[model samples]
Target: MESFLVLAVLTSAARAQEVEWRHDYTFARREALDKNRPLIIDFTTENCFWCNKLETTTFRDSAVLSLLNDKFIPLKVSAQLNPQLTEALRIQSFPTLVLAAPDGKILSTLEGYLEAPKLAGHLQRTLTAVTNPDWMVRDVEEANKAITAGDQARAMGLLKSVLEDNQERPIQVQARHLLKDLEKQAADRLAQARQLEDKGQNAQALQALTKLLKTFPGTQAATEGGQLLTTLALKPEVKQEQRTRRAQELLTQARADYQNQQFLCCMDHCEVLAANYGDLPEGAEAAKLVEEIKSNPEWMRKACESLSERLALLYLCLAENLLKKGQPHEAALYLERVIQAFPSTPQAEVAQVRLSQIQGQPTQQTDFKKAAEKEEGPAVP
Candidate 1:
């Protein structure tokens, strides 16, 4: 009687328990990469009968469930809904399954209906084959994945390693074949870098040469690129451009600092800009800002007030941290620093009170009368 009857669907909860399917390929891929799991991408269509049957029968099988749960990230990509992705993978037939690595390297593919046991066997065999290989095949697969991810350098490294391994494996031949393509790519990049250098675009050329060296380290193109990098980097035009760019950056920072009431730091940046890059337009602008800061009475008062307040706050913060660590004397040193440095700011008053508490006595402010009488005592030179 059992032989005469076809197997029917089992428990209602069987589908949920046996298979975990992800609809979005990107999310599934991220999860797979995070977990270091391979992927089983099930390509399907709404009208596909075999695809539905697999959900009911093949997915319900205990062996299939165990293999999927333990070893793979299962994703169901609908050909109808995801036409672009389907076209990318070229999934023409309904119910096509692709087993891929975590990095999106397709390891194997199967089409049409597969009985549960046969499907499980196929997965098991794939696992075994990937595990027991001479590593040349796996390295090639990884190289392919790197290339897909826009990491040509990594791909080249893997291919180079395989070739240098000196193994008699058949996959070594494939690696050699792939490396020639990589060599050509390296040469093309080297050519591009040279062209940029010839056009006097030193910065762009420098970047290209650097990338070339990194991408094709052992290639002849990389060797030439390295030599070219040295010659281009030493060009006075390149050096001048770099210096001018740095001067502009410093000038911008100085302006921001001045605007933010960080006057002392602004002075430091201003001095560097005026001294080193004084010939450049940015340097000249920086020099003008410096003169304005020193000559403007209102600006001087604001700079002095803000500098004192900021320094006092910093000292207070340090003192508080030391106090938390149960170092009262250490805390007192920073508190004293606030009194000596800024003696008039609000944080300085706070520091004085804290210092008095630590010393168990009243404290007097330090006298800077003699120092102030001298010519320019550490006040924004």
Candidate 2:
């Protein structure tokens, strides 16, 4: 019986890991609410040490789970992983707890850690208010329900009604601001679609561009939208196809630079990729690479390099980081840098050996000019 209890406990924990907790609010819009249940959100992040500890410690406590599961649809979101959702909810702190209505109006938000019993008490209190009709969540909830039902007009009408009902309430101004902010965001996205197409990301850029031009033609993006249509008309469909492939290659090379610890070069490549092809696969890839290496010391140093170190030393540091990381493919790149930038340095011999290992060749060191012409870029020793 003791052994059986151990297995059962482990099995339950594993099952809990399979729960879909982190999700977008927009995704909730399409979900059929229980109407009987309230929403409980636990926003977290992979990088937050406290959040990880909470999951392993407090959240894993059986009593905590029992109360949460019974009272609310316990949801978890990684704030870092889901940035848009984080921004939508104005989340500034990790381990944010939001008690929400089924229609998405927040009942309350708690920021930071809460011990088991306190957390359970908070949920119970919020549940009591949610179950009562006189609570402000009702009208706010109704307005969001309209938004979910694709009745934007009705949603705005409901919001207007709520504003009148809550005229003396402090949240009335905040509600008005939310409406304006939403409108501003809608306008911004339309503008962004046009800006994207203007730069040549036809496939990734066109759908939103076309939609905005149709839906909000009097907006600034629509006036600028003609330039994109003109560009599209001038290009052969074949050129449109070629852009994606080229963007992919650039993005791949940028990621290689990052993995190799050539931080500044990697970031530079990504910036060029994103700016030129923000709607393309390469642009997306570039953006991801940028975010991944944004915090690296090598990246920061390279970006701040003042040329105090000889060029060879820079390449050597880059190569060492890459090699330490076990990314031989990227390490080879920095080794080449060392050779071209500092041929006379004592490190050149080690770089040569690394290159040989990279290519599985007997070492016959080549000169920088020959290396560049053969490799199609500057040969870093």
**Using lDDT as the measure, which candidate wins?**
1
lDDT of 2 at 110: 90
Give stretches of model 2 more than 4 Å off.
Answer: 1-32, 133-381
lDDT for each residue of candidate 1 in 291-321, tens digit (9 for 90 to 100)? 8789988878888887777777878998999
Candidate 1, run of 10 with poorest lDDT: 3-12
Give the TM-score (vs. native) of candidate 1. 0.43
Q: Model 2, residue 4: what's the lDDT? A: 100
- Among these predictions, the greatest TM-score belongs to 1
What lDDT tens digits, residue by residue, belong to model 2 across residues 147-213? 5775544555555665664432324544566555445645686668667666766665666656655
* Candidate 1 residue-wise lDDT at 247: 89
